[model samples]
Target: MSTEILEQEIALLRQENASLKQQIAASIAELNTTIAKLEQEISEHKQTEVVLKASQAELLAIFNAIQDVILILDFEGRYLKIAPSSAPSLYKPPVELLGKTMHEVLPAAFADYFLDGVHKVLKTRQIEKLEYSLPVGDREIWFEATVAPMSENTVVCVARDISDRQQIEAQLRHQTKDLEQTLQELKRTQAQMLQAEKMSSLGQLVAGVAHEINNPVNFIHGNLSHLEAHIQDLLHIIHLYPQQSLETEISDLDAEIDLEYIKDDLPKILSSMKVGTQRIRQIVLSLRNFSRMDEADFKAVDIHEGIDSTLMILQYRLKEKSERPAIQVVKNYGTLPLIECYPGQLNQVFMNILANAIDVLEQRIESKDAPLPTITISTSLVAEGWVKIAIADNGGGMPEDVQKKVFNPFFTTKPVGKGTGMGMSISYQIVTEKHRGKLECCSIVGEGTEFVIEIPIQQ
Candidate 1:
C-alpha cells in the first residue's frame, strides 16, 4: 500500500510540473506580443517626428524666401514679431524692433500711418491697403502696404517697395507729353506747307491771266485814236459838200435818212469808245503790276505803285453793294524812296490785310447800323532806312486773346468754309520771314484795329 501511494504522489507532481511549463510558455508568448506592439509604436513615433521636422524646415525656407517685409503688430502698434525677410528693410535689426512700439522705432508720420492701418484692421476684421512714400537718405522710397487681422488683438502687415513702378509711370507721363507736343508741331508745319502751295498756284494763275489780257487791251487802245480821227475827217468832208451837188433822187434819200443827226452823233460815239478803251488799258496794266510774276527776285520797286495796283484790283468790292454801303479808303501817302523787296509776296501780304479789313468792315455793317466803313492807310519813312505802313479800319476789333493766336496756323474768327484760316498766318510769314520785316497789330475791342508793317529799304 505504501508503494502505491508514493506512485500517485509522483504522478501528481509530474502533472503539476507540466502545468507550470505550459504557463511559462504562454507568459513568454504574451511578453513577446507586447514587446512587438511597443516596438511598432516606437517606430511610428520616430517617423512622425521626422515628418514634422521636415515640414518645419520647409515653412522656414518659405518665410525666408519671401521678398516683402512681414510684420506682426499688437492692437496698440507694438511690434510683436518681424520676419527674417524684413532685415534689409527695417531701420534697425529685427531683434531691436521685435518688442518695441512703432512710435519708438519709426518716424512719427510713418508710425501714425501704420498704427492707423493696424487699428482699422483690428476693428473691421478686414484687410486694409495703403500706399505711402518716405524720404530715405537722399532718395524717396515708395511702399504699398497691406494689413490684415491675424487675431483679435494682432495684425499682420505686408509691405512692398514700389519706387521702381512709380518711376516708370512718371517716365511714361513725360514721354506722352513730349509726343503730344511733337504731334502739334507736325500739324502746324503741315498747315503752313499747304498754305504755301496754294499761294504759289494762285500766283501762277494770276500771272497767266494778266499776260493773256495785256496784248488784246494794248492793241485795242492803240487803234482807237486812229479810228476816232478817221471818223471825224469823214464827218467833216460830208459837212463841206454842198447840198445842190447831189442828184434829185439822192437829195430825197438823204432827207429821208436824217443825215444831220448821223453827222453829229457818229463823232461823239467814237470819242466815247476811245475813252472806254483807255480805261480798260489802265486796268490791264494794274493787273500786270500787281501780279509781278516777271519780278520774282528782289528788285527796286515803287511801293506806291504796288499799293495803287492793289487798290485797282479791289475797286469793284469797294463800290456800293446792295447789302452794304461803299467802303471809303483814305490813303495818306508820304514821299519815299524805292525799296528792294519781293514784289509778288509783298502784294500778297497787302491783299490779305486789305481783304481781312474789308471782311471785318462788312461784318460790322451786317451786325450794326453804324457809320460808313472806312479804311485808313498811311505810309512813312522811319529812322534807320525802314518804311512803316499803317493800315487801320473803323470796325469792330479783336480781343486780346484773339490777337495772341491770330498768327497761329488754322486759327480764325470766320465761320468754317468761309475762311481758310491761313491768310493771316501766311501774311505774317511773308512780312516777317520772307522780307525780314516786322508786323504788329494793335487793337481795341470797340475802337477798331490797326496793323503796322515795318520793312527795310534794301534787302
Candidate 2:
C-alpha cells in the first residue's frame, strides 16, 4: 500500500509542475506581444514628429518668400507684427518700423488713410482696400493696400508697390493720345489732297477760257479805231457836197436813211465798244493771273498781284446781291518785296479766307439790320524776314469755343452742304505745314474777327 501511495503523489506533483510550466509559457508569450506593440507605437510616434517638423519648416519658408508687406495692427493702428520680408519695401528698416505706430512711421495723410481702412475693416468685419501715393527718396511710390479683420481687435494689412503699374498705365495713355493725333492728321492730309485736285481742275478750265477769249478781244479792240476813222472820213466827204448839188435820188435816200442820226449815234457806239473791249481785256487778265496754272513751280511773284487776282475772282460775290448789300473791302497796302512761293497755292489760301469772311458778312446782313459790312486787309513786314497779312471783318464774330476749333478738320458751324468745313483747315495747313509759317485768329464776340497770316519772304 505504501509503495502505491508514493507513486500517486509523485504523479500528482509531476502533473502540478507540468501545469505551472504551461502557465509560465503563456505569460511569456503574452509579455512578448505587449513588448512588440510598444516598439511599433514608438516608431510611429517618431515618424509623426518628423512629418510635423517638416511641415512647420515649409510654412515658415512660404511666409518668408511672400513679396507683399504683411502687417498686423491693433484697433488703435499700433503695429503688432511685421512680415520678415518687409525690410526692402518699408520706408525704414524692420528694426525701426516693427513696433512703431503708423502715425509715427508714415506721413500724417498716409497714416490716416491706412487707419481709415483698418477701422472700416474692423467695424464691418469685411476686407477694405486703399490706393495712395507717397514720395520716397527721389521718386514717387504708389501702393495698393488691403486690410482684413483677423480678430475682433486685430487686422491684417497687405501692401504692394504699384508704381511700375502706374507708370505703365501712363505710358499707354500717352501712346493712345499720340495715335489719335496721328490718325486725325492723316485724315486732314487726305482731305487736303482732294481739295487740291479739285482746285487744279478748276484752274485749268479758267486758264483755257481766258486764253481763248484773249485773241478775239484783241482783234475787235484793234479794228474799232480803224473803223471809226473810216466812217469819219466818209461822213466828211458826204458833208462837203452841197445839198442842192446832190441828186433828188440821193436826198430822198438820205431822208429814208436818217443820215444825221446815224452820224451822231455812230461815234457814240464806237466809243462804247472801245470801253467794253478794255473792260473785257482787264477781266481776261485778272482770270489768267488768278489761275496761275503757268506758275506751278515756286517763283518770285508780286504779292499784290496775287491779292488783286483773288479779289477779281471773288468780285461777283463782293457785288451787291439781292440778299445783301455789297461787301466793302478796304485795302491797307504795304510795300512788300516779291515773295518766292507757289503762286497757285498762295492764291487758294487767300480765296478760302476771303470767301469765309464774305460768307460771315452775308450771314450777318440776313440776320439783322446791321451796318454796311466791311473787310479790312492790311499787310506789313514783320521781324525775322516775315510778312504779315491781316484780314479783318466787321461782322459778328465767333465764340471762344468756335475759335478754338476753327482749324480742326470737319468741324463746322455752317449748314451742311453750304460749307465744306475744310477751308480754314486747308488754309492752316498751307500756312504752317506747307510754308513753315504761322496763322492765328483773334476775335471778340459781336466785335470782329481777324486772321493774321505770317510767312517768310523766301522759301
Candidate 3:
C-alpha cells in the first residue's frame, strides 16, 4: 500500500509540475510580449523628447535672432518670463526683471500704462501696441511695444527700439519748417521785386504821359494865340459898326483880316483841341483801368478791355525809334465771355509779358535776317467754361532748357540790374494760385515763343 501511494503521489506531482510548467511558459510568453511593447513605447518616447528639445532650440534661436525684447507678463503687469536679449531698450537686466512686477521696476506712469495694455490685450484677445521712452542712464531710448494675449490672464510683450526712427521724423519736421520759412522769405523778396518793377514801369508811364501832354499843351497854346488875334480883329470890326462910314470900314477890315481864312482855321483849331482833350481823356481812362485800384478783389471784367489798357500803358516802348521799326502787335481776338478775375493782377501780368516781349523784339531788331518783330495776342473760349489768352512774339526764341525753368523763382535771362527774374514767377503764381489757371510756355529755337494762359471763366 505505501509503495502504490508514493508512486501515485509522485505521478500526480509530475503531472502538476508539467501543468505548472505549461502555465509558467504561457505567463513567460505574455511577459515577453509586454516587455517588447514597453521597449517600443520607450523608444517612441525618446524620439518625442528629441523632437521637443529641437523645437525648444529652434524657438530659442528665433528669439535670440530678433532685436526685440520678448517678455511674458501677467494681467497685473508682473514680469513672469524675460527672454535673453542684448537689446539696449531694456530698462533693467533679465535677472532683475523676472518675477518682479512692472510697478516695482518702472515709474508709476509707465507701470500704469503697461498694466492697462496687458488688461486690454486680455480683454480683446488681440494684439495691442504702445510706444514709450525710457531713460536708460542719462539718455532716453524710445521703444515700441506689441502686446499679445498668450493666455487667459497672461500677455506677451515684444518691444523694439525706435529711437532712430523717431529722430529721423523729428529731423524731417525741422527740415520741413526750415523749408517753409525759406519759402516765405522767397515770397517776400519776390513781393519787393514786384513793387520795384511796378515803380519803374510807373516812372516810364509818367514820362510818356508827360511827353504826350506837353505836345498837346504846346499846340493848344499856339492855337489859343491865333484864336485871340482872330477874335480881336472881329471885335474891332463890330465896334467900328457904330461909325458913319461903317460899310466901308467893315469891307476894308474884312479884306485885311481875311475872314474866309479865319472861318476856315477856327474850326480846325477847335477840332484839334477837342481831339487833344479826347486823347488826354483816353490816356487817363487807360491809366485808371490799368491801375485798377478799385478792382483789388475778384470781379467780372472784359478781357479785351484789360489787354487794351495794358497796351496803352506800355505804348511808349512799342513806338518806332531811331534804331528800329515799331514792334507790330497783332490781336486775334475771338468771341469770349466775361471772365471773373482780379483785374489789377491781370493787368500786371499783361504788363510784365508785354514788356518782356517788347524788350526781346527790340533786341532782335538788329538782326538783318530776323523776322518782323511782332507780338500777337490771341483770345478765345478754348473749352467749356474756360478761356485761353495767348501772347506770342516773333523774336529770338529761347532754348528748351531755359523755357523749362522760366516760371521758377529768381531765374532771369536779363542782365543783373535789368531784371529781377521774379516777374514771370509771380505772374505764374497769380494765374495758377490766385485765379486757379494754367500758364504754359511753348517755343521753337528759330521760330517764336508763346505764353498761353488758360483760366476758368467762372471762378
Candidate 4:
C-alpha cells in the first residue's frame, strides 16, 4: 500500500509539471504578440511626429516671411508673437512686443480700437479690415489694418502703411482740378472768339445796309426843295382871291370849298416834310459812323470818340437808378495821337475794360458808404511811340492774394451767377497776346484800383 501511494504521488507530480510548462509557453506567446503590436504603434507615432515637425517648420517660415505686419494676440488682446517683418525700422525687434497687452504697449488712443478689433476677431473668428491714421512717435502714419482669427482663443492682425499712396491720391486730385480749370478757360476763350467773329460779320452787314439806305434817304431830301417852291407858288396864287374868290372858286370847281384852309396849311406841310427827310438822312449818317464797316485796319481814330461810343452803349447801366451803387463817371480827356490798331478790336478792349471798371465800382458803392463813386478815364500819348490809357476808379480794390490769382483761369471773386472769373482772363489774353499790349494794375488796400494799358502805336 505504501509502494502504490508513492507511485500515485509521482504521477500527480508529473501532471503538475506538464500543466506548469503549458502555462509558461502560453505566457511567452502572449508576451511576444504584445511586443510586436507595441513596435507597430511606435513606428506609426514616429511617422506622425516627423510630418508634424515638417508642417510646423513650413508654417514658421511662412509667418516670418510675410511682408505685412503680422502679430499673434490672445483672446484678451495681449500680444503673443510679432513677426520680424512687422517691426518698423526705428522700433526695437519684434520680440519686444511679445507677452504684453496691446493697450499697455501702444498709446491709449490707438490701443482702444486695436484691442476692440482683436477681441472681435477672436470671438467671431471672422476677418475685419480697418483704415486709420496712427501717431507713430511724433508724426502720424496711415495704415490699412486687417485682423483675422488664428485659433479659438487667439487673433492674428496684419497692417500695411498706405500713407504714401494717400499722398499720391491727393496730388492726383489737385492736378485734376487744375486740368478742369484749364479746360474751362479754353472753352471760354473759344466762345469769346466766336462772339467777336459774329459781331464783325454783323457789323459789316449793318454798315452795307445803312449805306444803301442813306442813298434813298438823300434822294428824298434832294426833292424837298423843288416840292417846296411849287407848293409856295400854288399857295400864293390861291391867296390872291381868298374870302370872296374862295366861294366862287369852290363853285367853279363844283366840289372844292376849302381853298382858304388848303392855302393856309400848305406851307406847314412842305416845311415839316423837308425837316423829316433831313432827320432821316442824319440818322443814317450816324449809323454809318458807328459801324465803321468799311475800315478794320490800323487807321487814325479819335480815342475820345471811341470812349464816348462805349459809354453810349453802357448808358443804360448809368441811367437806370435801380442799378447797384448808382455809379458816377468822370472823364478826364487829353490830346492823344491816333493809335495804330484795329479800331473794332480796340473798341472791344475799351468796352470790356470799361465794363469791368463800372462793375467793380458798383460793387464798392453797394458794400461801403463812399461818397459818389467815380471812374476817371484818362488817355495820353506817352513817349517812345506808345499810348497810355489809364482807367482809375474809386471802388473796392482787390487784395494782394486775390490780385495774384486774378489772372488765373476760373478764379472769380464774384459769387456764382453774378460773375464768371473768365472776363478778366480773356481780356488779359486779348490785350497782351492779341494786341501785344501791356496791362498793369496799381491798387491800394482801401483807396481804389487803376488799370493802365500801354500799347505801342507804330509797331
Give each model's whole-structure lDDT: 0.81, 0.81, 0.88, 0.70
Q: How high is each candidate's TM-score?
A: 0.52, 0.52, 0.79, 0.42
- Residue 176's lDDT in candidate 1: 92
Which of candidates 2 and 3 reaches a greater lDDT?
3
Using lDDT, give the best candidate's number: 3
Candidate 1 per-residue lDDT over residues 311-412, each given as its tens digit = 777766676778888999999989889999999888877777887888898887455657678999999999789999999998899999999988887788
Cα lDDT of model 3 by residue, 158-225, tens digit: 88989999999999999999999999998797678888877866776687677666677788888899
Query: lDDT by residue for model 4 over 146-256, one digit each (tens)?
Result: 888888888777787778988998999999999999999988887885565446434543554455455546766666675675566566556756566576564564344
Clashes of 3: 0
Best candidate, TM-score: 3
**lDDT at 447 for candidate 4?**
80
Mark the regions of model 3 whose C-alpha exceeds 4 Å error after superposition. 1-45, 85-87, 200-211, 221-267, 367-371
Segments in model 4 whose C-alpha atoms lie over 4 Å from true places? 1-296, 323-326, 364-369, 415-420
Evaluated at residue 420, the lDDT of candidate 4 is 55
Our tally of clashes for model 4 stands at 0
TM-score, prediction 2:
0.52
* Cα lDDT tens digits for candidate 2, 152-204: 99999888888899999999999999999999999788768656545643564
The candidate 1 region of ten consecutive residues with least summed lDDT is 204-213
